[model samples]
Target: MKRHFNTTGPVIPEQHYCVDPMTRLDWEDVQYLIGAGKFFVLHAPRQTGKTSTLLTMMDVLNQSDEYQCLYINVEPAQAARDDVSAGMLTIVNNLVEGAAIRLKETRLRDWRETIWRNSGPHGAFSALLSRWAQESDKPIVLMIDEVDALVGDTLISLLRQLREGYIGRPGIPFPHSVILCGVRDVRDYRIHTKHHEIITGGSAFNVKAASLRMVGFNRAEIETLYAQHTAETGQAFEPMVFDALWEDTHGQPWLINAIGHELTWKDKTARDRSTPITLERYRAARERLIYSRSTHLAQLADKLREPRVHRIMAALLTGDENLSGIPVDDLEYVNDLGLVEIRPQIRISNRIYQEIIPRELTWVEQSSITHQQAWYLTPQRHIDMPKLLSAFQQFFRENAEAWIERFDYKEAGPQLLLQAFLQRIINGGGRINREYGLGRKRTDLFIEWPVDEEKGFYGDVQRVVLELKILRKSLETTLLEGVEQTAGYADQCGADEAYLIIFDRRLNVDWDDKIWQRQEQWQTRSIGAWGM
Candidate 1:
């Protein structure tokens, strides 16, 4: 009954099972925060399990006997932003409430008295920490989640208050340690937006001794998670399933858990045998998980639309190697959000994200005639190249205006959308191998469909190699370039047939005269015209 994969948010505490996917991280990372008597910051993108990690760490610290750890979300402070005093008041109250809930102390008389002694909110926070330190036998540790939810003056006041109280370590009667958790690093926080100036938050919130980033699940962790499912459910994950999962997800925790959860919990109809999940099943599960674009993915993609996220993603999607010249401010912003890892030439953080970004950003196909509906069209089992192209030609004519308008990054041209159009239909049953990026010269897409010949089924396969290019001033140069470029991909893929799709955004040609024509007798390729 346990799902073999999960492609969503952090695995739920116990109702939904999980594994410690990240071995590189340990309590030791947070241990330093506790020992230093300093403020600490833990940041990563939303749904990467910041809350889980914080709760788990709280458990770890509380068991040590020497420390009393209390974790709370300062989200209530968000709406009180108009009045800094009110926001601060809400935050302190939430902290007290959170502490009381865990400690089961209805009233910490001394803590309450000290918290309200000061003239301002910052003074109140200091006094409260001071009193708590004096009353409690164990050193106090505070964890605040969703710290970023407090914005503008509210955020500034919170950071300033914490910074002002930073000196209360061993000698001073303040909380021994504190942790601020959010979607950004303390150093990257632009709490104020006056005059378009970035006042580095680190300067104001300099108390952060260290900032720890939580990475997604790795290969071994993914395997262990599935193994846990196998151990509980009696059904196993096939060896190929592991390989496919690794290749597809590359250890994204949300994706790993979500894929398994869908296959196990959501798609009951797909489950028949008590045996391991096969590679085909895994692929099917992956497609379904992606198509659903469930909450987990929605949260992840929400960041993609931010300016910082957009810049980094655009560069990655376009393969702009010139990203070396990208401003440090933007990179820091994006890196803090976990859009792309810093090392290894600044690639997308992981494979799951890589796959999701294109599909998430691409045009959505809506029709009663779904790709699955078209599945029957290939009943003879061979992909009808002519028919597929003709269908797309008609589809493009009818929908290009509307669909092209939906595209956000038109600078890369409409070729990407064209591939995405054909991709939605083929992705489930087949695979669309995409090779595009900056300085790559051209984008290439290869669509491969498998045929089953054993059920007296004929082995009819479709191999399509599509080359996309942008049209400039003259059609002559673009077409000549496309011919040379497409010829290579066709030969490389050994495509049974190839088509060159030139997106004429400029609309130099007459729309009524648009034609799909074949080119080069020797190369055995066809060229299509879809223009304004």
Candidate 2:
């Protein structure tokens, strides 16, 4: 059977299309740390190949006969919540099961029963691990996946057990190296329990030598993945397709794989392999993935409702830089959840995520809009932007206060509501590509509508650029700046027409003053400007 891109679970090298998992990590450093018996961390956003990487490393280590390696997922313990005894019991059971399956070790079964019988709840975890380690002539390497998934006393108990085991290593027959894997660094965990006890993972797991974050695949890695499919089938991707995929996904492992899967298996025409995959096909695959609400994207979209997630995302959409009151750990938490990237300036993790956030934020409002895509289409099936913007201006005038209140991201209320309206119009036959971020003070939109109404992303397509900005200064100043910015963005997208929507956020602003549209020229380019 032909190997395919995997997004559901851990990738098996021979069974699924995969890249070298160690390529995303400092493999040599990790090996050295483990060899030296230093407990450490392996963390990344979910579905970024963390589990696959650990399993691969386990195989490599066990094959070398230098150490016995086991990967156990402790996420089941999360169901026990604050019940330390129940949580530890579940975790211990999982480890014994994992060892039996992975290591073919029957001793773990006997050890589990013996440890629990002799030691009781708190002592069971360390005792079983110590027994398992001593059972092997080669020192054992313990990999606990989703170590931070549990919270409250459950999380504290797990961490403390690992730390105790780490401290007693070499002499007391504990695992030589213990690697905890999860989405966030253990230090970032501020676990709350039913008893109202707030504990930090750092204080509990203080023996951690280092925390290594696994990130999305880089540009070259993404290319290599795509290249594999092309090589196997004698089909080639258009040169620009690679750049487009990279631009949209930024090499997010799941997103990258999802695009490949959708294009190959889901897209009928693209599966033939004789027809080369073009940029149009790539963009179409992206849209299908976005609207399908695949498990990965849905998981990310779900994070928007979290308070910590809301705090950063709320500021992000509206360019609210006054985020001093937001906790640093909150920001880190959002980053860990893979909603946004922390380095190279804070922004949504990818283009699809940027689009999904607003769509999700104003989904109710979008659903409430009675207008349909056909209502905004011209005779040529082109988007009637002037009419759409005019309608939005009226909607803003009437429903701004009521609709904005519904949003956690109220500062970007106008932008979100407008997108909600536009999304309704674009949902049928076109796609909206969005670009917005912290400190951008602007949201850029590119609407791609098939002009001839052909059934694919190709054929004569109409592209329009819309720039949304908030009026922080005088209207005259903001208008001029917006005109230039809109023109620049239009030029970037190669869009024929551009519009600037400036939202007046001032108190006591009159309806007449806030609602208007005019045509202006910026550096020989004409830009339609709207005040809202």
Candidate 3:
């Protein structure tokens, strides 16, 4: 079978176009750590090739005569929740089965039952590892995947067991080196016992020597992966598509592969290979991927409900810089989930995520909206900005209270509602690109509508810039600042039209006082200013 981009699971070299998993890690460092019998962590966000890397490492290590290696996923034990016995049994069974399948090692299978019966839930895992190390002719290297998936006391028991085995190391009957892998660093694990005490993973597994993080593919790696498809089938991606892909996915492995799969397979016309995938087609595929609500994207959206996620996301949406109140651990936790970037100023991780966040938040509201796209279109089929804004102002006045109350992200309700309303009107006809981040103090929205239907975005595109802000200062001061900001953004985007929307969230303000509009001139550009 011809190789294709893979998104479903660990990449199989013969069946998929893939970058070498080892290239994404510090191979030399990993080897030294294992050789020195260091217990360490290997963590990354979901679907970024953590399992694939671990599996590849296991194969590489086993191929060498140095050590016997096994990789096991303990995620199934999550079902046991606080049940330490059940969780341990499930995890040990996975280890035994994995050893048999991957290494043709049946020693674990033979000894697991007796060990569990004699040692009980807490001690069985530790005892089993000790026996495996003692029995093996060579040193044993174990890789545990989804280590954080186990919950409560079960997770605590597992960590303590690993720590117990670590104490023996080379001197006693224990694995030479063990790797615990998960979406977050082991230090972030806050396992709760049945007694309601939160035992952190750091405390439970203090024997850990180091923590290593796996990052997304870099530019050259992404290019190489895509180039594989071109080499195999002679299908070409336009140069500009690569630039857009990088911006859209930020080199996230699954997203890069997902888009590649979408372009080559999902869109039938592109399968011909002779038809080069252009930037426009790539954009369309991105749209489909987002709107399809694929399992991967849905899983990310599910994290929005978490309190830590909610707090950071709410701040990002509203452009609030008051993140001082949020704990550093909470920020780190959110960052570890791959929701946002932390170093070069905190923001959504990528353009695709930036787009997904608003759409997911306003999906229900957008669906419930009864307004027709044609109702706001001009005679030439262009979006009537003035009329749309007027209608939204009235809609906001009527439904703001009830609708805003229903949002989990109530801090960003007004802006989210506005996006929802705009999304309803522009559903199929245009695209809205959003830009917001911590300390931005405003959200910049750019709408791209194709006036010429036959040529689509290739001809006569309507570009409009909408700057959204909350009333943080006097009306006069806000209008002046907003007009300047709107003008600057319009210049950057080369938008033909510009609008500044000020949302007065003060509860003391009356509807009549808050609802208004006016025209402002900024450096020869006429900008529409609205109050709500």
As for TM-score, the candidate ahead, 1 or 2, is 2
lDDT of 3 at 372: 88
lDDT of 1 at 273: 39
Candidate whose TM-score is highest: 3
Model 2, global lDDT: 0.86
Residue-level lDDT tens digits of model 2 in 1-532: 8778887899987768889987879888998899888999889898999999999999999999999899999998888888888998999999888989999987888778878989877788898988877778888899999987886887877788778887876578898898999988888888896878787888888998998988888888888888888878888889998888887888789989988899888998877889888888888788888888777877787878877788788788877676788888888888888888878899888888888888878778988998877777788777889998998899888999898988878767888989998998888688888887777788899988888765656578788999999889888998888898899999999998899999887879788988898999988889999998
Q: What is the C-alpha lDDT of each candidate?
A: 0.68, 0.86, 0.92
**Model 1: CA > 4 A from native:** 1-14, 21-26, 81-83, 105-114, 117-122, 167-172, 192-199, 269-273, 364-406, 423-433, 448-461, 471-495, 504-516, 520-532
Instruction: Point out the worst 10-residue segment of candidate 3 by lDDT.
Output: 163-172
Query: For this target, which candidate reaches the highest lDDT against the unseen true structure?
Result: 3
RMSD for each model, in Å, please?
Answer: 4.4, 1.8, 1.1
Q: What is the lDDT of residue 435 in candidate 3?
A: 95
Q: After superposition, how far is residue 515 of candidate 2 from its true place, in Å?
A: 1.8
Per-residue alpha-carbon lDDT of candidate 1 for residues 443-520, written as tens digits (9 for 90 to 100):
677877776545211244567787766565377676777777777788888887776766565466655555455554
TM-score for every candidate vs. truth? Answer: 0.82, 0.95, 0.98
